[model samples]
Target: MEILDLGLDILTWAAILIGCFFVIITGYGLLRFPDLYSRIHAGGMADTLASFLILGGLALQSGLTLVTVKLIFIIAFLFITSPTATYALAQATFVAGLKPRVDEGQLDDTPPTDKVEGGKD
Candidate 1:
């Protein structure tokens, strides 16, 4: 095998390893994170990145096979659906009037009902 082929193999393995790492980190984040929003963020970030990495590595390994086409399809589905799921979750939180963390950056414009009415029910 050529040096270039060896390099590609190394990269493919690296991508797969990193994909596993993302999955593990997300699992840990789900257990360790303080709040729902933060946990959601971690889950989304890890899932998206891991999908990218795994699909990329699979594509590399698949070369010109039908597996590559299937991997591409999987990646496309993931890319389309993950963001939509995350957006729906965030919208649900917002519409449900979930409060953002105080340390969370750049909050929305909607004022809380308690703040406006001066004494929550």
Candidate 2:
């Protein structure tokens, strides 16, 4: 076996480090944020981004044809599914009428009128 190519090894390590950093930041966001809805945003966004980064790093490190193909599938799945899931969760929050933290009141606890003009028909 030849000495590990320094450049390739460095690249591999960098990718892995970046992926791990995304996960760490996600965890930190989840811990530091206030409110359940806000925390959900943090978690949803973090998991999506971290999943992409990790799949990408793993793809980079995969050195074989079949492994590369499988890695590509993983990347594809993550790209397609993660954001969709996040969007669904956010939509659920909206449909459930959870007031945004900035609103500073539980306004949504009362149903919003569907009227378009100053809540008038």
Candidate 3:
């Protein structure tokens, strides 16, 4: 029983750590990415994954409890809503004539260059 509990604790901590790492990366991406579309993509995807991982870790640590149930419900809600929200935002922006910046000249066989349009090299 003790060994089982120890394993569970380790798993819980690992999940939480990974989740936190994703959150950091998301923040960096939100800052580093150019254009609203890119920022939205990074924030939407990474935020959802991080929330799931963190909440799942908490649910595992809590075991069969009300907290776990609540966390599960929250995760479910996020799973349904995050992508939908992202799509809606993108659609609205597109309808409002906010086009994503695409370098059409670079669409061919040439490799990407180190020079970013609005970022440091």
Candidate 4:
């Protein structure tokens, strides 16, 4: 029993550490990504995966109990809401006329930038 318990603890810790790593990577993505769309994509995907890993770790640590139930509920909520929220934000940005940056090799489909006739040279 003791050995099993120790092994479970080790697995839980590993999951938590991996989750934290993903979160740190997400932060880096936010800083390094060149545009809003890319940043959102990176952050959203990492965040969803990280949440699953971290919550799974917590659920394992909790064992069979009310805490575990609550953790599962939280994970369910996150799973449903995160992607929906990201999609809504991206949609809103599109409706608001925000354009994503295009690389030289990529075909540009975004509307042309509006020129301000009186803007400073």
Candidate 5:
């Protein structure tokens, strides 16, 4: 029983540490990304994954208890809502005429840099 408890503790801590690492990366992305769209994408992805992992670790620590059950519900809510919220935000931005930056070889109404640069062929 002691060995099992020790193993659970280690696993819980490992999950938490990994979740923290992801959260740090997410913060860096939110600061360093070039545009709103990219920043949103980075933040949404990392936040969901990190939250899930962190909650999972907490649930493990809580074991078979009401706290664990609540954690599971929270995780489910997050998983369901995060993506929907991101999509809505993106749609709102689009409706507001916020154009996303596109790379070369992509189809967009925005004129290419080469064309704008004196029509160089």
Candidate 6:
């Protein structure tokens, strides 16, 4: 039982440390990314991953308990909503005429066939 406790502690801490590292990287990307799209991508992906890691770590520490169950629910909610929210935000920005920054060879020169006009489909 003592060994098992120690092992759980180590695993929990490892997950927490990794999650913290991702959170730091996300902050850096949000600050330094060249474009809104890149920033959004970093923020969304990192936020979801970090939340999962951190909450999973906490769940592990809590063992089989109500707190762990609640954390799992929160993780699931974030997993579902983060990407959807990011897509919605990006879509809204595009519809509002905020064009993404394009780089050379990133896309073809051809214009989009379905153009959004006045935020309409």
lDDT agreement with native, every candidate: 0.79, 0.67, 0.81, 0.82, 0.82, 0.83
- Candidate 6 residues 46-90, lDDT tens each? 758898899999999988989988998998888888878888989
lDDT of 6: 0.83
Prediction-by-prediction clash tally: 0, 0, 0, 0, 0, 0
lDDT of 4 by residue, 31-73 (tens): 7766678889887956588999999999998899999999989
Stronger candidate by lDDT (1 vs 3): 3
Number of backbone clashes in candidate 6: 0
Please tell me which model should have the higher TM-score, number 2 or number 3.
3
Q: Which regions of candidate 2 are displaced past 4 Å? A: 1-4, 103-121
103 Cα displacement, candidate 2 (Å): 7.3
- The digit string of per-residue lDDT tens for model 1 on 2-110 reads 9878888999999999999998998988777666677788889665889899889989977899999988888888889988999988877766666666664664444
Across residues 67-108, which tens digit of lDDT does each residue of candidate 2 receive? 878877877777788778777877776666565567655534
Lowest-sum lDDT 10-residue window in model 2: 112-121
Clashing pairs in 1: none
Ordered by lDDT, highest first, the candidates read 6, 4, 5, 3, 1, 2
TM-score of each: 0.76, 0.69, 0.81, 0.82, 0.83, 0.83
The 10-residue segment with the lowest total lDDT in model 1 = 111-120
User: In model 1, how large is the Cα lDDT of residue 34?
Assistant: 61
Error of 3 at 120 (Å): 33
For model 6, the run of ten residues with the poorest summed lDDT: 107-116
**How accurate locally is residue 100 in candidate 3, as Cα lDDT from 0 to 100?**
71
Model 1 RMSD in Å is: 7.0
- Error of model 1, residue 27, in angstroms: 1.1
